[model samples]
Target: MSEAPWWRGAVTYQIYPRSFMDTDGDGVGDLPGIIDRLDYVASLGVDAIWISPFFRSPMADFGYDIADYREVDPLFGNNDDFDHLLAKAHSLGLKVMIDQVLSHTSVEHAWFRQSRESRDNPKADWYVWADAREDGTPPNNWLSLFGGCAWQWEPRRGQYYLHNFLTSQPDLNYHNPDVRRAVLDEVKFWLDKGVDGLRLDAINFCFHDQQLRDNPPKPEDKRVGRGFSPDNPYAFQYHYYNNTRPENIAFLEDLRALMDQYHQVAAIGEISSEDSLATTAEYTRDGRLHMGYSFELLTDDFSAAYIRSTVQNLEAQMLEGWPCWAISNHDVARVLTRWGNGDASPQLANLLSAMVCSLRGSVCVYQGEELGLTEAEVPFEALQDPYGITFWPTFKGRDGCRTPMPWNNGINAGFSVGEPWLPVPAEHRALAVSLQESEPGSALHRFRAFMAWRRTQPALRLGDIRFLDTPEPVLAFTRRHGDETVLAAFNLSAQPVELPLDGIAGATPVNGHGLAQGTFADGRLSLPGHGALYARID
Candidate 1:
């Protein structure tokens, strides 16, 4: 039999470079800092690490707005630093995946600069450009994810350019074959650098409809979204013509064909659309993307029914494709604060770690998640994110989630000697790595134990999941792989409860992971609040 891919059921730890650690007293985490901390990351037993954007940028979107793909931002380090980091991570038995923002580029990008100069420039058509209407309004009612119109007037070209995100992030015109080739070549540059994989950022937004049509108004009942506030105007539209164009499929195939040349190299696309689940399925099937993940699990909904339905729905649609699951990341609020009802206890943290890893797909554990870190309270004056500045008190921006990771209780939480880019919350300082290392019962140790235990369970790693029909607050599922079948259950509520083990027989409980309290007697299972169970059944 052929060997499975390294990412099939791997646990990938996400490191937000800007907030991870700072080694040069720059108050910003850089490549060398990551190199210094490789041992700590590998100690967690993750198969790989996905580092957020560190390419040259104007800091418009904090590295998402790329000005140069080949050059590493001087603030982070030079190309040599990246090369060293890559070599070190591989030596530690951990794969390194870097973010590739292909859909858009900073307005300052050479291509965008040349394209915006004139209608007859060599790179004139490299970006999306359209003439303004007679009324001098935008080309259409297309709204930017940041705010206002998606079209920005470029006086040099006498036309408006499309920007799905901030005005500084102008969307590239994939309709142009040269644009497609250029982007693919940039991706090849990274693949040649010995990186194991690429996390394609906003991969679905690569192609936009040629005909710039006004997006229809979204219905009131369907206005809720994962990252933005309800009052934000961007959520009022159906967003049909702006993004998720069919042309993306062919581009993905081209990308996959390029990746196939490298042994065991993978590509995972980030999909967000009106029907993100359907889009995720389409992107991952037919050798297009190695894997795909959407905002379904990243939302505010936290319940047994919601999680079960979300996974089952994706499984039903994704016939031959793999899915990646992440409950927290740089973009969303910390899962514990969002789902734990402001509870960041070690018990709840351990339960969440086991619960997510028990699912059918590969997993992404965000930075500081193992520490059970809560969202930092960044005051308005200290805010750095443009999204938060646009919608202040009404909706706090993502700054709360992007604060620097606390390493010690010393000044700046041991993140830096200088004033950090973002303030380190006092609450987070109390849960520092130094403090947790001494306590065996700390959330950090518990998470490490669970990940180690999970690696030994093939049923949990690479198996077919079958969710059991349990009560409201209890989630039960069985994973079957070859001759091994394991049953897993979790209590989602704060109150202890009893569950009847029906149709389950010849089971032996697995122990050693510091999970919450649970007991089984007389065919009945008694579970304490935030408890979890894993039993091998013959």
Candidate 2:
């Protein structure tokens, strides 16, 4: 048997630390809470767990704005708590991948603090700083992903610093060799502590256009940001100068060289750019990132053609690099609610899980996804996400998806004794883990069954995929590896569909998996609403 790396075709469960579980009665989940639920995570039969940021931060952008790379935030826990979580996860045969935000740091970060104090400081060039224009305007027309201008003025230095997301988070200058070395050293600290891998946050934004050129205005017809609403002005430009710079490739190469020293450690980058698919291909190619995932699949477009086109486009561009697929994550709304037209059904959730896993790459399943959780309704009063608050009513932001995970149908959904950071939706409580555990046909049970069975199928685990021509709402693909060929198909709509199975001969049905099994007869396959099938082609 070939010794493939552990991350290849692996399934990673994403745990948003703030909403996963809370044990300290502080209304916020912590490292100890994660450790307490290691058994529950392991029970899902996932290959790994990718924890979102828990590093020392001011919580400006929740944990994205890092105040210190080496220290754990008191809100999450201390370093010892992290060590214990890592050890416990490993003991359960689960690889642990922590989120690493390398592009920017919280303004409260010591490096940023010193850099902003004066121009001649030792760390003055550590961050991207520039003088204002002669007219006293920002250095360029760059816009922050959150809102307004990307430049934040610092009176102490009499200059403006670039902030792609929030003013509290200043973008670092990779042009400075010292900055690169320092960030790499911080990453090395985690590797030394035996982290299995890293899920690099905003990896493409590490290096900005040094010339401070203004980004060209995007055509009105092309104003759609990947994951943002059209109302946000950030989508009005091409974003060429602010992010996705060509210089980022070299830094990735340097980071990859450092990781190569460690045994079996991997890096997966999160790419969000004007052309994220192309950027994903570039970052993962040539010994940079082991894997790359974009927001292509996470968008609200839930059509068979869109999914096929996105995967095929990436496959064509990603020459020798691997791809990771995720339907939902911390930044986006829950897939069921987003794609189901407001109907969150067990069938839709189960079908999505199977469909994404059957694709030609590794996969990530967000927490609460197993229980068919929909997007929680966070009213304006309860809103905590700045992104949503900034664009209220028009775009409610990510807090709905980041609400506390429902463990039981009790007060606070058994997430915490005290109030949660975000309110748990009553609808989520209806589909709690406790309630689903007892029901054999629940989404949670079906998810576990499908994942367990997926591990046994080598073709699905690691195989070449070829999409078969099918009509609307029906997707068909075949996976083949070493004389083993498996055919998988799904109906991505609410109505039943009939598909003609051409070129498929003598296929043996695979059973006992809790998917909505479709029937094949007389060269015609009949699939019910949200139906799916997996078979071995003899």
Q: What TM-score would every model get versus the actual structure?
A: 0.98, 0.99
In candidate 2, what are the lDDT values of residues 1-538, reduced to their tens digit? 1478999999999999999999999999999999999999999999999999999998989999999999999999999999999999999999999999999999999999999999999999999999999999999999999989999999999999999999999999999999999999999999999999999999999999989999999999998865586688999999999899889999999999999999999999999999999999999887899999889988889899999999999989988899999999999989998899967789999999999999999999999999998888899999999999998888998999999999999989999999999998789999999999999899998999999999888888889899988888999999998999998989998788997889887677787668889877677878889998788887
Q: Which residue ranges in model 1 land beyond 4 Å of their true spot? A: none
Evaluate residue 290 in candidate 2 and report its C-alpha lDDT on the 0 to 100 scale. 96
- In the predicted model 2, the residue pairs found to clash are none
Computed on alpha carbons, the lDDT of every model, listed in order, comes to: 0.90, 0.92
Best by lDDT: 2
Candidate 2 regions exceeding 4 Å error are none
